[model samples]
Target chain A: MLQIMEGSHAVAEAVKLSRPQVVSAYPITPQTHIVERLAEIVADGELDADYICVESEFSALSSCLGASAAGSRVYSATTSQGLAFMAEVVFNVAGMRLPIVMTIANRSLGAPLSIWNDQQDSLFLRDSGWMQLYAEDAQEAMDLHFIAYKAAENHEVLLPAFVCFDGFILTHTFEPVDIPKQEEIDAYLPAFNPYQRLDAKDPISFGMYATPDYYQEFRYEINAAMTRAKKVLREAGAEFGEMFGRDYSGLVEEYRLDDADTAIVAMGSVCGTIKDAVDEMRDDGKKVGLLKLRSFRPFPYEDVRTALAGVSNVAVLEKNINIGSRMLGAVGLEVKDAVYKNGTPVYSYVGGLGGRDIRRKDVKMITEWAETGRNDCFFGLREEVL
Target chain B: MGIFLRELRIHGRGGQGSVTAAELIATAAFKSKIYSQAFPAFGVERRGAPVQAFVRFDDKKVRLRSQIYEPDYIIVQDSTLIGDVNVFGGMKKGGIAIINTEKEIEGVPDGVKLVKIDATSIALEILGLPIENTTLMGAFAAATGEIEIHALEESLRERFPGSLGDKNVAAAKKAYEIVKGGL
Candidate 1:
C-alpha cells in the first residue's frame, strides 16, 4: 500500500522487510528517525529481530560486526560524526569479510557544528573497502538498502556495504514508495548463511594480526573481492528490478546520454535537480544528460566509461570537496580517467558543499560551459573578488 | 496512498505549529494512502525560527528524492513565512498557495494561483488554538482541490488515533466548508 512516509522511515521499513537478525544503532539527527522506527518495530513485535540500543555509533557497528561474524545478518545506521566515531569499525567489518549492511544518513561534519545534509561523512570513508551506494531519493534509498544487503552477502563478494542518503533531504522528506511485502523481500533475499564463523565447536580465530609477509595477500584478497562485487552489484540489481518492477543499472544510472553532446556526473539527491535541468535544456534544444553514480566504492570505472564515451563533453559535480586539490575527487577524476584516451574533455565541479543549496539553474549553466570545452568550471558561486 | 507529497513552507515565530504543522500534514497525508515527507529547515532547530518542510506524493512510486525545490503546490501555514525564504521559489507556474493570515492574496506576488483563508480563526473556532495546521489543510483542499477533505480527515484519524484526531477532523471539516463556500 502507498503511504506517506519520510526518508528515514522508508529506510526503517526496508530494514524490517529485509529481515535482519540483529540491528544496532546510535541515534543522531536525520538518522535518528530510522532507528527510532526500527526500535518501535522490534518493541511492538512488528519485526522479529534483536534491537540493540547502543550508547554510541562506534558500539553500534562493533556489535553488528560481532553479530555478522557469528553468522547472523546484521544491520546498523549512523550519520555525520556518529559515522566518524564508527570509522575504525567500518574498516574492520570489511577486513573481516562480514556481510553487514549499514545505512548512512549523509550529513556534514561540524566544527561550527551543523546537523544538515552534505556528503562529507560518507566521503571520508570512501576508501574503507565497503561498497558505498549513494541514493538520490527516498525510494532509491529504501531500494538500495535491499540491493546493498544482497550484494554484500553474495558468497563471491562478502564485503560490507553502506547505502547513503542525503541527511534531511531524503531522511526527512516524505514521498510515496512501494513497500514490498516481507514475503516478497524474503523471496528475493535468502537467509544469511555464513561462509565461516567463530563457532565454539569449530574454534577459529578471526581478524588475527598478520605480519608483513601475509598482510599483503590478505589486502589483495579483499581488493579482489571488491572487484567481484561490481559484477555482483550488476547481477543483483538486475534481479531486484525483475522481482519488483524497478530497474537499477547497479553501478550507475544513466539518463538521456545517447546522442547527447554534454552531460553532468553526480551522486545522491542533487542528480534529481540535474535531471530536471537536463530535461528543460533538452526541450530548448540542448543535448544534455545525467550520469548518476550508484556504486561509488568499487568506483564502477568500466560502466562510467561506457556511459560517457559518446558524449562530447562531461562535467562532474562533487558535493564534498577534497579541499585544495582544485580537482574533483572520486567520481570526477574517475570519469576523466574513463574518457581521457578517447579525447572527450571532462570538466570537474566542486559544489553544494556543507549543505549550500545546489540549484538546477546552476547545473544548466555548468553544462553550457562544458559544451565550449573549457578546462573546467564551477557552479552557483559569486564571481571571485580578485 | 494517504501520503500527499507536498512541500510546505510555514511562516511563524518559534512557538507556532509550523514544523509541528508540517509533521501533522505529513502524518495526515500518510494516512491518506500517499506518503508525506515533512521536515523543518532550521539553522538552530529553535522555535520561533523560520522553518520549512518539503513533501512529495504520487499514486506511483516516487524516486527523484531531494528537497522539493519545485513544488506542485505550496501551503504557507503562516502568512509570515512569505518573506523569510523563497517560499515561491521553484513553485509550478499555475501551482496553488494556501495562506493563513487575513491578508488578501491578490496583494501578494503574481505567478501561481493564491488562496487565502483566516486559518487562525478557523483554528480558534474548531480546535480553540491559533495554530492553523489542521485548518490550513482544509484551505489546502479547497484551494488545490487535490486531496479530498474526507481524505484529510481520515489522515488525521490515522495520525492522531484519539480525541486529538477527532478535534483535528472537526477543524478540517469547518475549514473545508469555508474554503468550499468561497469557491
Candidate 2:
C-alpha cells in the first residue's frame, strides 16, 4: 500500500517483511531508525525474531555471524566506524559464505567526526567480498533489501550483501512509498533454506583455517561467486519486478542518455537531484543526462560502457574521494577505466562529502566543465574554509 | 498542479519537534493528494540549539533530495532564533512566513507576508507544554491554504493518540481558527 514514511522506517518495514530469525545491532551514534523499528517489531511480537543488543558493532556482526553459522537466516546493519570496527568479521562472513543481508545507512568515517551522508563508508569495504547495492530513494532502498537477500542466498552467489542508502539524506527523509504486502514479499523471497548449515546432528567446521595453498583458492571461489552474482541479482531483480511492477534488473539505469553529449554517472540519493538537474538542463538545450549505478560491486563495466557508448564526455559526480588517487572519486576511477576504450574523458567531480548540499546549478557547472576541457578536480572547495 | 513547486523551511531549536512538524505537514499534504517530502538539516540536536527542517510540495513526485536553500514559505518555531540564524534568508517574494510569536519580528524579508501567532501560548494552554509544532502547523495551513485543516488534523491525531492527541488537535485547530479569522 502507498503510505508516507521516514526512509529508515521504510527500510525497517521492508526488513520486517524479510522475516529474519535474528536481528542484531548496536545502538550508538548513527544507530539508525531501522534498528530501532526492527527492535520494536520484535518486542511487540509483530515479527517472530530474537533482537540481540550488543556492546559494539564488532559484537553486532560477530553475533550475526554466529547465528547465521548455526543455521538461521540472520540480519544486521551498521555504518562508518561501526562497519570499520566489524571489518574482520565483514570479510569472515563472506569467507564463511554467510548470506547475511545488512543495510548500510552510508555515512563518512571520522578523524574529524561527521554524522552525515557519504558513500565513503561502503566504498571502504569494497574489497570485503560483500556484494554492494546502492539505492537512490527510500522506495528503492526498501525494495533492494529483498533483492539483496534473494541474490546473496542464491546457490551460485552465496555471499553477504550491503544494501546502502545515504545516511541522513535517505534515512531520515519522509516520502511516499508503496510498501509490498507481506504475502507478496513472502512469495518473492521464500523461507531461508540454507545451502550449507551447521547443526548438532551434523557438526561442521566452517571457515576452517586454510594454509596459503587453500587460501588462494578461497579468494578465487569468492571472486567467482561475486562474478556470478551479476546474473543472480538480475534474475532476483527481474523476479522482483514481475511481482512488484518495479524493475531492478538492469545493473545501471540510463536516464535520458540516448544521444546525450554529456553524462553524469553517480549512485545513491544524489541521483534523484541529478535527474532534476538533467531535466532543467535539457530544457535549456543541453544534451545531458544521468547514468545511475545501482550495483557498485561486481562492477558492471560492460553495462557502464554500453550505457555511455557515445557521450561527448562524462562527469563522474560521487560523494567519496580516493585520498590521493590520480582520479579522486572512488567510482570515477573505475568509470574512467570503463570508458577508456572509447577515448571518453571522465572528469572526477567529487563533492557532497560530509553533507555538503549539491544544488542544481552545480550540476550545470560540472556539465560545462566536462564540455570545456576543464581539468578534473574536486568540483567545489571553500577557499575560506581551507 | 495546484502547487507546481513549493518549498518550506522550518526553523526551531533542537529537541523542539521542527523535524516532526515538517513531517506532519508533508503527511498532511500527502493525505490531500499532493506529493510532499520532508527532511532536516540537523546540527548536533542538543536542546536550545538552532536547527532547520524543510518540506517540498509539488503536483508531481518530489524527488529532489538536496536541502532547501530557497523556500517559498518559512515557518519559525521560535522568534528568538532569528538572531541565531537567518530564518527568512532565502524566502521568495510573495511567499509567506508563519512565525510562532506574540509580537511582530524585525527585518521581515522583502515582499514576504508574515503571519504571527502566539503558538507557544496556545500549545501551553491546551497541551501544557511549550511545544508549538502542532500549533504552527495549524497557522501554516491557515496562512498558506496549501493543506486542508482537516487533513492536518488527521495526521496530528494519528501521530499523537488519546487525550494528548486530542489536545494537540485542539491546539492546532485553535491556532487555525485564529489565523483563519485574522485573514
Candidate 3:
C-alpha cells in the first residue's frame, strides 16, 4: 500500500509486520515516533505484541533481552544519548545472541546537548558484534527492518542487528512509501525459530560466567557468527529482492559506475543526492558514479575493493569523522582498508555534520575534486572565516 | 496537470508554519492531480527560529532530484528570513516573491515581481496566533494566480479534518483576498 508516512512511522510499520512478540521502548529524540506508533498499535490491538514501557533505555534493551531469551521475537529503538545509556546492555544483547532488532536513529552524542543527526552514537557501538545496516530513505528504513530480523535469526548467524537511519532527515521527512502487503512479508520471513530457548523443560544455562579458558572461544564464536552473517545478509537481501523487488546488498551499492574514472562514495541519504549529481554529470560527459555503503559491519571489504577496481580515484564522504587521525575518515576504516593493499587511491570527505543539509552541487564538487586526483580537505565548511 | 512541477521556497520562523505551509501547498497541489513533494530545512532553532522548506509539484512524474536551487516562486511567512538568508537567491526571472511584512520591499533583484501582504496580521486576527503558513500561501496564490483560492480551500479540506480544517481554509481565503485587494 502507498502511504504518506514519516520515516520513524514507516519503520514502526515494518516492525509491526515483522511480528515481533515483544516491543520494548524508551523515549528518545528522533526515535520517539517509532516507539510512539508501536505503542499505539499494541494499544489498539492492531498488533499482538507486549509493548513494554521501560524505565530507561537500559531497561528497554534489557526487557528485549529477557523476551528474546525466553524465545520471543524482540524489537526496540533508541537514538544518540539513549544508545549511549544502553551501551552495556547492547553488548550483552549481542553476547547472548538474542537476535533482537533495534533501530538507532543516528544522532550526535554531546556535552553541548544536541538533538540533531550524526553517526557518532551508532559508530561508537560498531564493535559490539551486531550487524549494522544503514538505510538511505524512509522506504529503505521500512524494508531493512525485516531484513534485519531475518538475517539476525538465521541459525548460522544468531546475532543482533542495528538499522541506523539519519536522525530527522529520513525520520522527519514525509515520503511516499510503498508498504509491502502482510502476505508478502510473511512469504519472505518465516516464524522465529530460535536456536536455543530458555524453557524450563530444557533448562539450559545462559549468561553464565565463563573463565579465561572458555571466554575466548565465546568471543571467537561471536566473531565467526558475524562473518557468517555477511553471507546471510546477502542471501536474505537477494531473497527480499526476489519477493518485493527491492535490492539491499551488504557493504556497498553501485550507482552508474560503469566505465567511470571517478566514484563518489557515501552512505544513507547523501546517496540520493549523489545519484542525481551522477546523472547530470554523466550527461555532461563526466565519468562519475556512486558507491553507497549499506552494511557497515563485517565491512564488505572484498566487495568494496571489487567495485572500485577500475576507478583511479574514489571520494569517500563520511558524515561522521574519526577526528585527530586522518581527516574525513570513518571510524570503521574498512573503506580505506579495502584499497590499502589493492593499490587504489581513495579520498575521504566529511560533510553535512550536525544536521547540515548536503546539496547536490556539494556532492558534484566532491566528485570534481576526486576526478582531478588532487587531495585537500573539503569539509563543506559551513562558515567563511574573515 | 494539477501538479505544477513547482519549486517553492518558503521563509518563516520555527513555529510560524513555514514548513507546514509548504506542505499544505504541496498537498493542495497533489489533490488537484499534481504529484507533490515537500521537505523542510530544520535546525535546532526553537519556537522562534528562522526556518525554511522546499516544495515541488508537477503534472508529470517528477524525476528532477536537485534541491530547489532556483525556485520558480518564493513565499515569506515571517519576512524577517529575507535579510537573514538571501531569501531571493536564485529566484527565476519573473518569479513571484510574496512577503508577510507590512513594509514594502525595496531593491529586490531585477526582473522579479514582488507581492507584500500583512498575512501575520490576518492570521493573528483569524487564528488568534501568528502562524502565517496558510495565510501566506493564500497570499502566494493571489499574487501569482498560480492556484485558485477555491482549489486551496479544497486542498485544506483534503489535508486537514474537522474545525481546524475549516479555520485553515478561511485563513487561506482571507489571505487571498488581502493579496487580491493589495495587488
Candidate 4:
C-alpha cells in the first residue's frame, strides 16, 4: 500500500524489511532521522536486529564490520563529517570483503561548517571499493537499499555498498512510497548466507598483515569482485524489478535522450529538476535530454557510453567540485573518460554545493552552455559563466 | 507521469507547524491518489523565526526537488509575515491565498483571490492551543479542492491518534465548514 512518509523513514522501513541482524550507527544531521527511525524500530521490537549505540562513526562501522565477519548481516548509516570520520574503517570493511550495507545521506564536508546537501562526503571515498548507488528520489532511495543488500551480499560479489541519497533533498522530503510486506521482501531477498565467517572451529584472521608477496593480489582480487558486482547488481536489480515492478535494469536511466543534440548528465535529486527543465526545453524545440546515473562507483562506464553515444554534446552537472584541475568533478571526469572516444565534447558544470538549489532554469541554461561547447560553466551563478 | 501539477507554499514562524502543514496537506493529497510531495527550506529554525514549506500535487510522481518559486496557491499561517516575508511573491495570478487573520487585507493582485480566515481563533477554540496548521489544512482543502475534507481528516487522525486526533479533526471540520459556507 502507498503511504506518505519521509525518505529517511522509507529507508528505515526498507532496512527493517531487509532484516539486518545488526545495525550500528552514529547520528548526524540529514542522516539523523534514518538512524533515529531504525533505533525506534529496534527499540519497539518491530525488528529483531541488535542496535549498537556507538560513540562515533568510526566505532559504528567498526562494530558493523565485526558483526558482518561473525556471519551476521549488518547495516549502518552516516553523512558528511561522520563519514569522514569513518574513512579508515570504510576501506577496511571493503578490504576485508565484508558485505555490509550502509546509507549515505550525502552532505557537504565542512571547514565552512555546513550541515547541507552535497555529494562531497560520499565522493571522497570514491576509491574505497564500495559500490555507490545514487538515488533520484525517496522511492528510488528506499528501493536502492533492497538492491544494495542483494547485490552486496552476493557471494560472487562480496562487497559493501552505499545507498546514497541527497542529504536534505531526499532525506527530509515527504512523498508517497510503497513498502513491501516483510514476507514479500523475504521472498525476494532470502536470509543472508555467508560465504565465510568468524567461526571459532575454523579460525582464520581477517585483514591480517599481508606481506609484499601477497598484498598486491588481494587488491587484484578485490578489483575482480568489484567488476563482478556490476553484473551482480543487474541480476539483483532485475530480480527486484520482477518482484516489485520498478525495473532497475539500467545503470543509467535515460530521459528523452534519443536523437538529442545535448545530454545533461546528473546524479541524485537534482536530476528531477533537470527532467522538468528538459521537458520544457523539448517543447521549445531544444534537443536537450537527461542521463540520470543510478550507480556511480562501478562508474557505469559502458552504460553511460551507450546512452550518450548519439548526442552531439554532453554536460555533466554535479554537486561536488573537482579542485586543482577543471577536467571536471569526480563524475564528470569518469563520464568524459567513458564517452571521450566518441569525439563528443563533454562540458562540466559544478553547482549546488552546500545545499545550494539547482532550479529548472539552471538546467536549461546548462544545456545551452553544453551546446555551445562552453568551458568552466558554473551553474546557479551565470555571471561566472558569462 | 501525470501532466496536471499544482504547487502550494506555506509561510509561518518556527514551531508553528509550517512544515507539518505542508506534510499533512501532501499526505492528504496522496491519499486521494494524487502524486504529492512536500519539503521545507533547510534552515536552522528557531521559534518565531519565519520559515517556509512547500507542497506539490501532480498527476505523475513529483520529481522537482527545488523550492517552489511559482506556487498556484499559498497559506500564510501568520499574518505578521505578509510584509516581513514576501508571502505573496511568485504566486501565480488567479491563484488563491488563505491567510490566517481577521483584519481586511488589501492590494491583492488582479486575478488573485484572497480568503482571510481567523484560523488561530478557530484552532484555539477547538484544539485549546494556538497551533493552526490543522485548521489551515481544512481551509486549504475547501479553498483549492486539491484534496477532499475526508482525506484531510483521515491524514489528521492517522498522524495524531486518539483524542488529539479527534480535536484536530474537529478543528479542521469547523474551519472547513466555515470556508465552504463563505464560498
Candidate 5:
C-alpha cells in the first residue's frame, strides 16, 4: 500500500524489513530521524533488533563493525561531521570486509558549522573501499537500503556499502512511497550469510595486523572485491527492479540522453531537479539530457563514458567542491577523468552548498554555459559576496 | 478540476503547526487519491521564529525535490508573519491566499484571491489552544477546492486520535463553514 511518509521514516521501514540484527548510530541532523525512528521501532517491538545508543559517531560505526564481525547483520547512519568523526573506523570496517550497510544523509562539513545538505562528507571518503550508491529520491533511498544489504552480504562481494541521500532535501521531504512487503523483500534479499565471521567454535582471527609482506596483497584483494562489486551492484539493482517496479538497471541511469548534444550529470536529490530542467529545456528545443550517476564508488567509469559518449558537451553539477584543487567538484573530477579520453568537454559546475537552493533555472543556465565551452566554475556564486 | 499539479506554501511560527498543516493537507490529498507531498524548510529556528512548509499535489507522483519556488496557493497561519517575512513572495498570479487573521489584511497583491478566517479564535473555541494549522487547512479546502473537507476531517482524526481528534475535526469543520459562508 502506498502511504505518505518522510524519507527518513521510509528508510527506517526499509531497514526494518531487511531484518538487521544490530543497529548502532549516534544522533545527527537529518540522520537523527532515521535512527530515532529505528529506535522507536525496536523499542515498540516492531523490529527485533538491538538499538545501541552509542556516545559518538565513531563508536556507532565501531560497534557496528564489532557486531558485523561477530556474525550479526548490522546497520548505522551518520552525516557530515559525524561521518568525519567516523573516518578511521569507516575505512577499518571495509578493510575488515564487514557487510555493514550505512545510510549517509549527505551533509556539508563544518568550519562555519552548517547543518545543511552537501556531498562533501561521503565524497571525502570515496577511497574508503566501500561501495557508494547515491539515491535520487525517497523511493530510491529506501530501495537502495535493500539493494545495499543484498550486495554487501553477497558471499563473493563481502563489502560494506553507503546508501547516500541528500540531507534535508530527500531526508525531510515527505512523499507517497510504496513500502515493499516483508515477504517480498525477503524474497529479493535473502538472510544475512557472512562469508567469514568470528565464531567461538571456529575461532578465526579477524582484522589481524598486516605486515609489509601481506598488507599490499590485502589492499589488492579489497580493490579486487570492489571491482567485482560493480557486477554485484548491477545484478542486485536488476533483481530489485524485478521484485519492485522501479528499474535501476544501469549503474548510471540516463534520462533523455539519447540524441542530445549536451547533458548534465549529477547525483542524489539534485538529479530530480535536473530532470525537471531537462524536460523544460527539451520543450524549448534545447537538445539537453541528464545522467543520474547512481553509483559513485567502484566509480562506474565505463558506464559513465558510454552514457556521455554521444553528447559533445557535458556539465557536471555536483554539491561537493574539492577545495585546494584544480578539479572543481569531486564528482566532476571523476567525470572529467572518465570521459577525458572520449574528447567530450566535461565542464564542472559546483552549486547547492550548505543547503543552497539549486533551482531549475540554475540547471538550465549551467547547461547553456557548458554549451558555450565554459569550463570549471561555481554556479550561482554571489559576485558581491566574494 | 483540470489542474495537473498544485503547490502550496504555508507560513507560520515554529510552534504554530505550519509543518503539521502541510503534512495534513498532503495527507488529505492522498486520501482523495491525488499523489501529494509535504515538507518543511529544514531550519534551526526555535519556537515563535518564522518558518515555512510546503506541499505539492498532482495526478501522478511528485518527483521535484526542490523547495516550492512558486506556489499556486499560500496559507498564512499567523497574520503577524506578514511583515516579518515576504509571505506572498513567489506566489503565482491569480493564486489563492488563505490567511488566519481576525482583521482584514492589507497590501495583498492584486489578481490573487484572498480568504480570511479567525482560525485562532476557532482553535481556542474547539482545541483550547492557538494551533491554527488544522483550522487554516480547513479554510484552504473550502476556499481553493483543492481538497475535500471530509478528507481533511479524516486526516485530522488520524493525526489526533480520540478526543483531541474530535475537537480538531470540529474546529476544522467550523472553519470550513466560516470560509464557505464568507465566499
Candidate 6:
C-alpha cells in the first residue's frame, strides 16, 4: 500500500523487510531517524532483531562486524563525522569479507563543524574495497537496501556494501512511497546463509595477520571479488526490478543521452534536479542530457564511457572536491580518465557542498560552460567572499 | 493553479510548527488524492530562530528533489520574519501570501494576492496556546482552494487526537470560516 512517510522512515521500513538479525548504530543527524525508527520497531517487537545502542560510531560498526563474522546478518548507519570516526573499522569489515550493509547518509566533513549534506565522507572511503551505491530518492534508497543485502551476502562476492543517500535532502524529505510487503522482499532476498562461519565445532581463523608472501594475494582476491560484485549487482538489480517495479539494472542510468551533444554526470539526489533541468533544456531546443552514476565503486568505467561516447562535451557535477589535486573534484577526475581514449573534453564543476542548493540555473550554467570546454572550477562561487 | 503543479514555502521561527504545517498541508493534499510532498530545510536551528519548510503538490508523483526556489504560495507563520528574511523571494506572479497577522503587512510585491488571518488569536482562543500551524492550514485551504476544508480538519484531528485534536480542529475550523468570510 502507498503511504506518505519521511525518507528515513522509508529506509527503516525497508530494513525491517530485509530482516537483518542484528542492527547496531550510534545517533547522528539525518541518520538518527533511521536508527530511531529501527529501535522503535525492535522495542515494539515488530522486527525480531537485536538493536544495539553502541556508545560511539566506531563501536557501532565494530559490533556489526563482530555480528556478521559470527554468521549473523548485520546492519548499521552513520554520517560525515560519524563515518570518519568509524573509518578504521569500515576498512577492516571489508578486508574481513563480512557482508554488512551500511546506510551512509552523506554529509560534509567538518573543520568548521557543519551538519549539512555533501558527498565528501563516502567518496573519501572509495578505496576501502566496499561497493558504493548512491540513491537518487527515497524510493531508490529503500530499494537499494534490499539490493545491498542480496549482493553482499552472495558467497562469490562477500563484500560489504554502502547504500548512500544525500543527507537532509533525501533523508528529511517526505514523499508517497509504495513500500514493499515482507513476503515480496523475502521472495527477492532470501534468508542469510553464510559460506564461512566461526562455530566452535569447526573453528577457522578470520582476519589473521598477512605476511608479505600472502598479503598481496589477499588484496588481489579482494579486487577480484569486487570485479565479480559488479555482475552480482546487475543480477540483484534485475531481480529486484522484476519483483518490485523499479529497474536499477545498470551501473549508470542514462537520461536523454541518445541524441545529445552535451551531458551532465552526477550522483545521489542531485540527479533528480539535473533531470528536471535536462527536461527544461530539451524543451528550449538545447540538446542536453544526464547520466546518473548509481554505483560509484567498482567504478563502472566501461558503462560510463559507453554512455558518454556520443556526447562531445561532458560535465561532472560533484559535491566532493579533491582539495590538493589538479583535477579538483573526484568524479570529474574519474570521468576524465574513463573517457580519455575518446578525447572527450570533461569539465569538472563542484557545487552543493555543505547543503548548498544546486538550482536549475546552476546546472544550466555548468552545462553551458562544459559545452564551451571550460575546465576545473566551482559553480556558483561567491568571488567577493574569497 | 488549482490543477497544475503548485509549490509552497512557509517561513516561521523555530517552535512555531512551520514544519508541521507543511506536513499537514501535504497530508491534506494526499487525503484529497493529490500527489504531494513536504520537507523542512534542515539546519542547526534553535528555538525562535528563523526557519523554512516547503511543500509541493502535483497531479503525478513529485520527483524534483531540490528546494523550492519559486513557489506559488507563501505562508508566514511569524510576521516578524517579514523584514529579517525575504519571505516573498521568487514568489510567482499573482501568487498568494497567507500571513498569520492581525495587522496588515506592507511591501507585498505587486500582482501577488495577500490574505491575513489572526491565527494566533484563533489558536489561543480555541486551543489555549499560540500554535498557529494548523490554523494557517485552514487559511491555506480558504485562500487557495487547493485542498478542501474538511480534508484539513480531518488531517488535524488525525494528527492531534482526542480532546487536543478536537481543540485544534475547532481552531482550524474557526480560521477557515474567518478567511472564507473575507476577514
TM-score of each: 0.91, 0.98, 0.89, 0.98, 0.98, 0.98
Model 2 Cα shift for residue A371 (angstroms): 1.2
> What C-alpha lDDT, on a 0 to 100 scale, does residue A366 get in candidate 1?
82
In terms of lDDT, which candidate is stronger, 1 or 5?
5
Superior by DockQ: candidate 1 or candidate 6: 6
Q: Mind listing the fnat for each candidate?
A: 0.39, 0.76, 0.24, 0.82, 0.67, 0.71
lDDT of 2 by residue, A214-246 (tens): 899999999999999999998899999999999
Q: What CAPRI grade goes to candidate 4?
A: medium
Q: Where does candidate 5 chain B have its weakest 10-residue lDDT segment?
A: B1-10
With candidate 6 superimposed using the best TM-score fit, by how many Å does residue A178's alpha carbon deviate from the native?
Answer: 0.9
For model 2, how many clashes? 0
Model no. 3, DockQ = 0.32
lDDT, candidate 5, A347-371, per-residue tens: 8899999999888899999998999
Tell me the lDDT of candidate 3.
0.81
Candidate 5, CAPRI quality class derived from DockQ: medium
Residue B75 in model 1: shift from native, Å? 3.9
lDDT, candidates in the order shown: 0.79, 0.91, 0.81, 0.91, 0.90, 0.91
Q: Tell me each candidate's RMSD, in Å, in order.
A: 3.3, 1.5, 3.4, 1.4, 1.4, 1.5
lDDT of 3 at B95: 85
Give me the runs in candidate 6 sitting further than 4 Å from their true place.
B1-3
Runs of candidate 5 with Cα error greater than 4 angstroms are: B1-3
Note the clash tally of each candidate. 26, 0, 4, 1, 0, 0
Candidate 5 Cα lDDT to native = 0.90
Return the lDDT, model 3, position A279: 79
Per residue, candidate 6 scores C-alpha lDDT tens digits across A105-186 of 9999998888889899999999999999999989999999999999999998999999999999988888888899988988
Candidate 1 chain A worst ten-residue window by lDDT: A377-386
User: Candidate 4, B74: how far from true, in Å?
Assistant: 0.8
lDDT string for model 4 (A204-285, tens) is: 8899999999999999998999888889898888988999998997888999999899999999999989988888898899
**lDDT for each residue of candidate 3 in A1-386, tens digit (9 for 90 to 100):** 66555678889899989999999989988889899999999999988999998799999999899999999999999999999999999998888888999999988888778887878788888799998898888888899999999999999999999999988877876656779988889888888998999999979877888898899898999999999888999999988888888877555798888798988887777777787678788889889998888998868888888888888888888778776766466732667688787677778777677776677788888887777876646466846751
Chain A vs. true chain A, TM-score per model, equals 0.96, 0.98, 0.96, 0.98, 0.99, 0.99
* Candidate 5: TM-score, chain B only: 0.96
